[model samples]
Target: MSSDVLVCQGISKSYGEGEQKEQVLSRVDLTFQKGQASVLIGPSGSGKTTLLSILGCLLAPSEGELIINSEAVNFKDKSSLTEVRRLKLGFIFQHAQLLPFLTIKENLVVFARNTGMQADDIEQRIQLLIERLQLVAMAPKFPSQLSGGQRQRVAIARALLHRPSIVLADEPTAALDWHNGQTVVELLLDQARVEQAVLVVVTHDVRMLPLFDRILAIENGIVQVKQNVK
Candidate 1:
């Protein structure tokens, strides 16, 4: 089996039309292997989020292909795109985005159930993630009741619960303190490694850059590999 889990080929994204058209990404090419954690950094309007969105299948690139697990994504096929997201991708946003009415565990369960996990397996997975994320006590608490860091921890658990092949995070630590941010990133990296998932994080924090296996920097609609460890 191939180690490559996520591959972007000649990916390009633009907005508007003709003279009004604005290019956001230019023939960007990236390959993320299993168990690889990459941090993407760039200026505010450097198209970092645009590229991430394409990778997450939330948006279609104007010109290029996105392949996950060797299958080319069909942007025109809504059902297929939905399936790809549900079966192959996990996402963590800047905010925890947990359902306010549901308890932490319930939040995780909803997604697991949506992905067609069996009741027994869902229960087991939830238990394992709760313990691993040190979110045992918070599991029964509602999202509104938990601290920011605690909520983010639950978010991590929620994202990893289904064992998706690709994990994408967008400024996950943006709303937390440095200590909490560091802790959350560490936990995310550790869990992704355990799952052998391709982890891609978009951040403006240069401080957290070194924690990832590779650092991808975007400038003027182009992506440049700033660093790669091992």
Candidate 2:
């Protein structure tokens, strides 16, 4: 069996129509292996987020085929695409994007609930993930009560709550200071590896670039492999 977790071939995307149409991505081919951390670096408006969205099933490419863990996914149907996203992908945004009214525990459980997981085991898995992510003490706190780093940590725990096969992160460390940013990166790398999932991070920070297994650069709507220093 192939070890590829994500496979994209000749993917293309555009927005608008007619003469106003703008191509955001063009023929982007990529593949990510299980347990590997792939970092995508690019300038603003360079289609890094566009490509990530496509890979995460948030957006459909104009023409291409994507195979996730050997299963073909049609990005055309809205309902089916939503189901695929819920069942197969975990997303971590720049901000934690937690509900201010919900506690950390509630956020995690809510994720499990939406994924059709057993309600009886929600607490067990939530606690386990909180402990694993070193957020056990903050489980009872809401997003407003925690620091930026703590909130991001909770977000990561929530993302992993349902045990998705792939985690897609967008500027995960953009909101933190030096120490906290490094800490978050390390935590993400460790948990992603431990869970045996493919991690694709879209980041502008070069500080954390060395830690990734592979680095790809996006420019002019194209993605090219860059040398990994570490």
Question: What would the TM-score be for candidate 1 when compared with the true structure?
Answer: 0.98
Pairs clashing within candidate 1: none
lDDT, candidate 1, 1-230, per-residue tens: 98999999999999999999999999999999999999999999999999999999999999999999999999999899999999899999999899999998889999999999999999999999999999998888999999888988898888888899999999999999999999999999999999999999998887888899999899989999866654
- Backbone clashes in model 1: 0
Q: Name the regions of candidate 1 deviating beyond 4 angstroms.
A: none
Q: Quick one: best lDDT, which candidate?
A: 1
TM-score of 2: 0.96
How far off is model 1, as Cα RMSD? 0.9
Q: Per-prediction count of colliding residue pairs? A: 0, 0
Residue-level lDDT of model 2, residues 1-230, one tens digit each, is 88898999899999999999999989988888888899999999999999999998888899888889898788768898889889889989999899899988888888889999997778788878888888888988889999999988987887777888899999988999989988998899898999888999988889889999999899979999876766
C-alpha TM-score for every candidate: 0.98, 0.96
Q: How much lDDT does candidate 1 score? A: 0.93
